[model samples]
Target: MFRQTHIRLTFINSIVFIVLISILGSIIYFYTDNKLYEDVNQSLLKSVDHYQNTDGPEDSQGGKLGEGDQAPKFMGRDPRILTLIWDENGNLLAGENRGTMIFQGNEKLIRPKKYGTLEDVQVEDFSFRYVAFKTELPQVGKITVQVIRNVNSEKELLDRLLLIILIGCGVGIICAVASGYFLAGRALVPIKKSWQKQQQFVSDASHELRTPLAVIQAKTDLLFRAPQATIQEKILDVSTISKESRRLSKLVTNLLTLARSDSDQLEMKKSTFQLDELLKEILQQYEEIAMYQEKTLRLEAPEPVAFLADKERFHQLIVILLDNAIKYTKEGGDILLSCTQSHSSISLKVEDTGIGIPEKDIPKIFDRFYQSDKARTEAEGTGLGLSIAKWIIDKHHGKIKVHSIVGQGTKIEITFPKSQK
Candidate 1:
């Protein structure tokens, strides 16, 4: 059904285009025909005048004159003549096909007053277009002369030209339909690829959740089997169950957040806030966690730098960066958070002295389900943090940049427009 629908659309569009082109070609052909007729009529009038004034009666009979005879001088070379002359009583005097000339209603030709050429008329099973000129002959006064020429050959040529144009238009339409089909397929390939990736995401997420779920189930079963088990063993089993349950909950939350973000259903409350103050508050919260990990956290900010943005989502972005720094930094490593304002924009930099990222993997760090080896092994995360951060920043009309060197450190810089407020 889809293929049939596409073909129909293509065919209709082709037909409309062909009709437009044909109309244009018809207009041009009519213009050319008018010009050709005007030229031919002018030449015929000049030839008729010369024959009436100069030629004797023998020359008019389609024969050579005698000694001292004068000849008619026609305007163009190789002229084809068809002439008719009428007397005062409406009877033919001299011409080719005289008996077949059917005059329709007292039609008279006037000089220098007509613009377009005359129409075709049938005469004795032959079609012709005639230009009539009135002249006075010295011997025979008030002679009405008509110059008529057959147009069947020219009409046939014009019909053949129109046929060629129709053939060209048909070929063009076929090419257009073929091109449209291939282009539509090429455009849909990316959509198909995204669908496949979504299927794989669901499969991987199910497997990840099952591991923690199975651990919780097995621990509860062991507790039920050993009713007289030692109190210490029972407490250990309860703790393991609680920890795995918490891990599973966190994973589910992360997955749900990603799903909502992808669907564009995550609503944020937007307001104006002091960015400097917000950074200080986030740093304070991270400092406590840094202390427990034996890591030093520091902040640098220009005084009272304000911004208009979504406060809660901005806080989440800061939290993701800080948590990542804490997880990857060795004991006693330093983490710095700073904000700087420029002429039209503000830059927020989060730099850490930690186990840095490899150059090749840096490009894909913010992609969904991506995690570096060191971060994956050392932390409990769903690999959606950076992806979420990127989305939030994009919604705020900002940009993020990262610079890192292996074994040295990594720096993430987020630039926001000052004019956003």
Candidate 2:
């Protein structure tokens, strides 16, 4: 589809450019031709004017003569000129003898009023452009003068210019086609990257969700094997199965949310809400879970901080961060939540005294299904908590970062624009 569209657009553009160039070239050609004709006409008129203004009769050696009987002189002496003069009786008066021979059988050449200017005519074997005009003598009879020249050179130049235009346009079209292909390919690179990421996301989601499902299935089968067992053992097995099932369900839900976010199908309702209040609410809900695991959850915000955002998604974002902090922190470790607002943006920080991530793993910790401890498969997460948190922040037009030191702690800082609601 993209290829076809690009080609169609390029073709249309090329046609438009070709038409414009052709129009401009034609305008230039005709203008140049008109100018050439005007210059030639002015030169011919100047020659005629000089001939008409000559004063006296012929010299002793035929040096100069009056306009009535004298032939027009070629000041530039160009060989192309073919001049002629005739009397009223169809007899030759002066000028080139070739004109006399040509007009000997044509009586139209002697008529004063019939003589035309700059007319196309054929004499002998050559085509010529001829101009004829008459001037009356004081005492002698009327005489006609005609000037003729060839037009083959001008036609040759025009033909060469048209050939050049054709060749140049062909080459320009070829280059445009090549460039269009390359530009379209470059523009689609981002789409190709997004597609590859989506494929990886699908594969990772399947692998991560399958593990908890398999655990739940195995635990359920063990419960069936011991139908006659004690109540305590059966209760323990059922509880384990239920926990794994819940874990798998949460993973699937997060996966769906991430997919919706990626496809831009998730709708968010924007409103002004208190960020500190939202964080406090999430902390209170997760406090029971933290206490059950023998961990301490704390909120460090000294005052209320307000922000513009989707209240529900903002709650989910805080829940994800607090859950992660509790999961990674050891029993009796500290988990802190805090928020600060500035003129342009606001920042929320979640710090935990946990088994901090390694330097290399920290960079990819937010990637789907990526965990720092490869050998610690006993952990109960599908490894999508940070990924989901990151997606939520991105959808809100915010940024998140992590600072970690192995065996020391990890701190996650998220910043949201004040106007991004």
Candidate 3:
């Protein structure tokens, strides 16, 4: 899917580039063509003006003006200019630069019928831009002036300009495609990671739920089928069924909470509360469990600190950390819960002298459904407790971190801004 998206983005970029280049190229081509024609027209107009001003003699050749008139010479005159004159009777009477009219049908195209306007003329492989005007000279009858200029050089230049634009457009599109693909790949990296995590979460949840469900089904079936069993055996079967059901329910609840968090729908009811009192109550509740597990539990919060947080979720966070510590600590090992406050921030720490996590697995401890090998074997959990704790801390706008050395101890620290009274 990402590959297809990349291709599509590249295609769009290429098309946009092509259209922009095309517009720019067309503007340049038309502007250059117009300028070239304007220069040629200016040259022809000046030459024709010089001929019209000259004094000349009348001749019997159809009442036309003859050559040999002393026409004023123009400085920097174009050599390709061809001049022709015709009488009012539609007869070709005189011409200048006659040797330059080398193309066939040049003579037949210079009459009153072809007079009065500027036009393009093609005569047997020669191209000409010509203008005709009626003018009368001193001592000469009225005649029409036809001025022509060669345009092969301008045509060649336009062709070359078109080729350059085509080449430039081709190169630009190729670069656009290559760069677009590279940028699209860079952009998709984070999205790809998120998609992979979602898939893994679904697979893990399915497996975890399936385990407890299978156990509940088997235990219930045994209780129903073995009707003749002793009462104690029946009670044990019922107990197994109840435990599995509770485990299944807890897994489902955790999954739901994570789903809600993912959708940004997890709301926290925030209020100011005494931090010391809350920590003390949580520790007292865990005291019995710690004793049963043969682990020493302690709290080291002396000063009362107030904070703004979701009271219930904050309590749940502390419970998750304390429970994890108690579960991992060996018999007679110590578990410490402590809180401290400064002028601006409140810090909480849960340190345990337990089977500490390996250094490599520390980073992934808060990832959903990610359990280390030791955690899977030694603890009965769905591995989502720390994930939930992290989510709660995030909602409270706090930071949490862990430090651990294998077989020695682990320390988890969290910090939040102190509340203003």
lDDT of 2: 0.71
C-alpha displacement of 416 in model 1, angstroms? 1.0
Off by over 4 Å in 2: 1-174, 218-233, 376-378
Clashing residue pairs in candidate 3 (N, C-alpha, C atoms within 3 angstroms): none
Worst 10 residues of 3 by lDDT: 56-65
State how far residue 269 of model 3 sits from its true place (Å).
4.2
Tens digit of per-residue lDDT, candidate 2, span 302-374: 8778787889888888888887788788888999898988889898999999888888988898888777785
- Candidate 1 C-alpha lDDT tens digits along 1-421: 4466556656666566667766877786787667656666666656555555665223443653333333321122214545555545544553233432443322343111221344466554455666555555555556555555666666666667668767766775676567656655565567667777787778778877998999999999999999998868699999999999998997898788889988988876778899999999888877778999899999999577888889999998999999898888889899999999888888999999888998999998987777788533467666778988898898888988899987778999999997663
TM-score between candidate 1 and the true structure: 0.69
True-vs-predicted CA distance for residue 163, candidate 2, Å: 4.8
Listed in order, each prediction's TM-score against the native is 0.69, 0.65, 0.69
Worst window of 10 by summed lDDT in candidate 1: 69-78
lDDT values, one for every candidate: 0.71, 0.71, 0.79
Taking every candidate in turn, the Cα RMSD to the unseen true structure, in Å, is: 8.0, 7.5, 6.3
